[model samples]
Target chain A: MIPNNISKLIDAIINKTEAKKAIWGKTSRNEEFKLFLEKGAVTTDTWVENGIEAIDFAIYNSYGDKIDNFVAYKGDDDFDILSRLHNTAKREFFKVDETIENLFKELNDPKSVGKRQIEDDTPLPF
Target chain B: MKKTISISIIGVVGIILCIYFFEDSDKTLPNYATVIGTICSIVGLSIAYINILALKEESIIISKQIHLTLEKVNQLNSLSEISKAIKVNQEIQEFLRNEKIELARLRTLDLKYMLLHFNNDLLLNELTSDEEYKKLILDFGIDLNSLNETLINSKRKVDFTKVVKNLEELSTYLTKFELKLKSIKI
Candidate 1:
């Protein structure tokens, strides 16, 4: 059976991943978030003796830069760490949405458009 | 049978050495026959001991291989269950796309039940003791729960696009997870 804190950490990681998917539409490039759980020194073949040590959650931007990271050790409170990371993710997502909205607005504004004419010198065979 | 023969050989050699030593107490210097017998007995005991140790080591290696194979089989079993669940999820998505709410709802319920059974099976297996594997199972359950809630909330007016998107995400996640499980070298 999993410990209570470890269970909470697992749930938090799943929740964060789901939220990212909800916002970014399931693409790996868009969902640039990762949660890594540290485990004790144990062979991969022996699952029964594995132990948790820490959990780390990281968020990255489209440019592949790390924007935020949250780490929680074994003794730290899982809920507090997760909530803080969740709020940061929420804020970052809003920022991206706002940027996209502003870009669309700029593209749609008629004042930002400049008309251009193409002059073709080659004669066409009719 | 090999071990038994080795042990019997050692026991007979030990008994012969004991008899040879006890019977030659009267003579100060040992005869060539007794010396030759003792040397042969020593050689036989050494060979038998080495053979026994080699057999023990070979058995240990074979047992470990069997254990690793069993672990891989269990992981593959879980991956197949996930594959089945992915198929059902696709059918649910199709039903939703067609606006067959009743059919989709039934299928959603079916999927929820299927995942419930899968989760229980994972918990029962030793694989759940692994942190990475447990997280994968938990993530899968969370996605299924989200889909179930979305389906249940919107009864008459279903969000076709949203539900389909969720199903697609779930399918993609499951495929990646299946690959991850397959990549695990036991």
Candidate 2:
């Protein structure tokens, strides 16, 4: 089950995505990319060659670790590389979704960081 | 309309009198009076028919003119709205640009303080070596070099050029629309 804050954040993201398929153009991927964007994903344009389009994106976990991903689509025929990039970014970022969720849960917890059970010597796996 | 109807009625009466007068004229010797009357009556009839047609055409032209005027007014209104949008976009773009630059500057200052604190902490405790200090700070994800580099590379240029261009295009279109409207006869 999603936490109350998480659920509310997701709703805000979804609500802000207006006619996603229309604005971004239709793609086979689900609309999860919008959520990833809202969660602080950064995308950059890459070089295109020989009817191929490319874009790169960096997704940051709550711990500030970056996951890089790229999407390459055919430039010809109404193909939308931006939407594809979003989907790829989201998918790559999802690999560490559990860590991110745990981080958020820890942050939202009532206890301060000093009062937490974590030991000073304990290394963070982030 | 009443004047046109009255003239038409007079024209019909004139034509009837001309015909009645001409009915008695000998075919071999044409009657000058009858011919003159007939010519005058025919001219009058023609003028009355032309006048009525002109009135109808004038009404149509007036209505068409009103429509064109309304369209012109609407286009002007749209141009004003677009101008307002462009103004707002420019203000927002400027604000965002300044805000980003300020934020980046502040972040760099914060990072410098963090580094100073780290150095101060090391000085107070003389046991830790330089490499160990660097490693401990790096482990905590506070790479001063990377952070400084990022701050140097950060750009805060908010581009509202495309939006401005689009609005300008719409303005141009409205100007052209106005020109087209002016060229219309109605």
Candidate 3:
């Protein structure tokens, strides 16, 4: 589970972004947060299914600005540091699992990961 | 003080009345005793509730201190990392390679310091021994790890040579991020 404080922080950041004129529904930070909110604290979950991909989403999203905004690390040595990061990618993967599981139980109708669907059907035009 | 005294007196008097005069007559004595018992119970519960409220206030104070500590640590680390990353040029990759040993050494020392702080602030605290504390620390470590990787991946995927004909391109954006990280405090 995301620490309530961290969750609040992410919400605050999103709120800060929301006040601005952005074309996105949820800011990148909010999207990263929606990853780890699971039904329970621990157990069989989504991380076990797609570990690397889950963490990659969070990392890339969180670093989107730094990655694109700065080019200092756009080199071989930088790649070395990033490769080291993937080794710990399991954390984000677990977050994804937890988030999906949370939504499942939150709706009070557990379903296979593939069968889960969000209520918002409309896509953002932007 | 008046409430306390009244509750106490009401409680004791009811106890005394119930003891001798009211004991033999269960009907009268028990009735009087119930009134005293209720008053004493209410007063006791009120005092205990007040104590709990005080404790909650104290905990909020402690959590604030911890937050301040975390902010200080993050700020120092963020700006230093920004400075380290920002100052380097197209030749930074090769230059950093030469100083890789020192960089790794610094990282090791920093990790040791972090571990020490975590042990003191988290492991030594009452909650430090708790499972939740352990999980929190572990998750924090994992998050930091992933952050390192994201930085690497983003830089690796991009073609630097295309933009690195001069230092101006890299320096322009690096300074912007440096300002962003150092928005107010250096």
Per-residue CA lDDT of model 1 for B1-186, tens digit only, reads 565566557767765666567655544445545655676677667777777888899999999999888888887787887788799889988887787767776776666565555546642344434454444433333333334434554321324675577567657766765776777777
The models' CA-based lDDT, in order, is: 0.53, 0.42, 0.40
iRMSD for every model = 16.9, 13.5, 13.0
- Model 2 over residues B18-116: C-alpha lDDT tens digits? 556665544324565666567667767777787879889999999999988976675455445434433443443343345443443344344334333
Clash pairs (backbone) in predicted model 3: A38-A98, A38-A102, A39-A102
Better-scoring candidate (TM-score), 2 or 3 = 3
Which consecutive 10 residues in model 3 chain A have the weakest lDDT in total? A40-49
Second chain only: TM-score per model? 0.54, 0.32, 0.41
Stretches of candidate 2 off by over 4 Å are A1-32, A35-89, A92-126, B1-52, B98-186
Residue lDDT tens for model 2, A1-126: 223553354344334443232122211112222222322333323334454544433334322234443344455322343444444434344534557878899999998865558889999899
Best TM-score among the predictions, by candidate number: 1
lDDT of 1 by residue, A1-126 (tens): 335664565465546545654331221212222233342110000001125344344433321223343545455676355444444454444556568888889899887565676569756678
The TM-score each candidate achieves on chain A is: 0.27, 0.27, 0.21
Which candidate achieves the best lDDT against the true structure? 1
Instruction: Summarize candidate 3's per-residue lDDT along B1-186 as a digit string, tens digits.
Output: 565566567667766765547545565756766866776787788767766777899999999989888776775665565455444342343433453423433453344244334345421244334444343333333333323433554322222232232223334544554465455442
Clashing pairs in 2: none
